[model samples]
Target: VRNNGGGHANHSFFWKVMSPNGGGEPEGALREAIENAFGSFEEFKKQFSEAALGRFGSGWAWLVVSNGNLEILSTPNQDSPLSQGKTPILGIDVWEHAYYLLRQNRRAEYVEAFFNVINWEQVAKNLEDASS
Candidate 1:
């Protein structure tokens, strides 16, 4: 029951992290923070997208803020970083339901579209809240 609750909560936040009209680069402290933590925005995107695609089964990809740094990670089967002591700044549901309607098995294409719809403002706010 607790695990099911966690999955629903995680998926809820995941939907808001993206929109039809979101994406590009993050701004303000989030941008600077990404640069500092991952070396550059491009690198950050590459790492994040790679992590999203690398997961072998149903799961999520995440950008989490931990110890004042940003990190990319993957969690399988409804697991969330919230359970691991990290704050989730951004999340992408790699579960097939997230993309199967539009992308079928083309996970990479789905990931690319995911980038096109990232709510960076929400991510920045999450990062700020987490940092503080």
Candidate 2:
């Protein structure tokens, strides 16, 4: 039950958080929070990418809001940060089906490509909602 539900919710969130016109750096409050949490956006990307790449298999990496702070987390299978009382502001699916066709076995390449399409505006909205 939870697996199916989580998958549906995660996929829905995933689709909304990416756009063809996305990428580049965030602005305003979202940008500040990211820099505050991870030192700099580049560092956050490095850590987030490492989290995605380090996952053993078939999982997701996320930027979540927990207790009014931001965090990077990795969850195996179809699990969600929601279950842990965290709000996922951004996430990336590392499952093979998500990248096999384009990235083959190079998961690092796929993770890097995700930054190209990240919907920072939408992610900022999510951060605001979570903060409230």
Candidate 3:
């Protein structure tokens, strides 16, 4: 069930944190948290994108809250941070299947485009949920 269950949860969470009207810097508490964790929004993007791109195979890049701290990490296959007791605030699927149709192996392009549709509000809610 690890694969199927994790895939379902991961993909479900993935879609939830995206929106047609999304694509802007997060604000409020979430913004401060991000800045504190990664120095700045631009730096966060850079590091997150790098983590996503660095995954060598089908997997996910995640921004997770572990032990009350924000972290950037990658999970292979359909793995979820839940297995490690971490809370995923945001994530991006790095599996080729997620971007092959449009990016055709150019995962970087898809990762970049994903920024344009991120549902920061949902992410903030996730952070709050995780925190509480």
Q: Per-residue lDDT for 1-132 in model 3, tens only? A: 999999999999999999999999999999999999999999999999999999998999999999998999999999999999999999999999899988898999999999999999999999999999
lDDT score, residue 94, model 3?
A: 93
Sequence-dependent TM-score of model 1: 0.95
lDDT of each: 0.89, 0.95, 0.96
| lDDT by residue for model 1 (1-132), tens | 557987888988987788778888899999999999999999998999999999998998999987778999999989989888888999999889888998899999999888888989888888888999
TM-score pick, better of 1 and 2: 2
The C-alpha TM-scores of every prediction are 0.95, 0.98, 0.98
Clashing pairs in 2: none
lDDT of 2 by residue, 2-110 (tens): 7899899999999999999999999999999999999999999999999999999898999999999999999998899999999999999998999999879999999
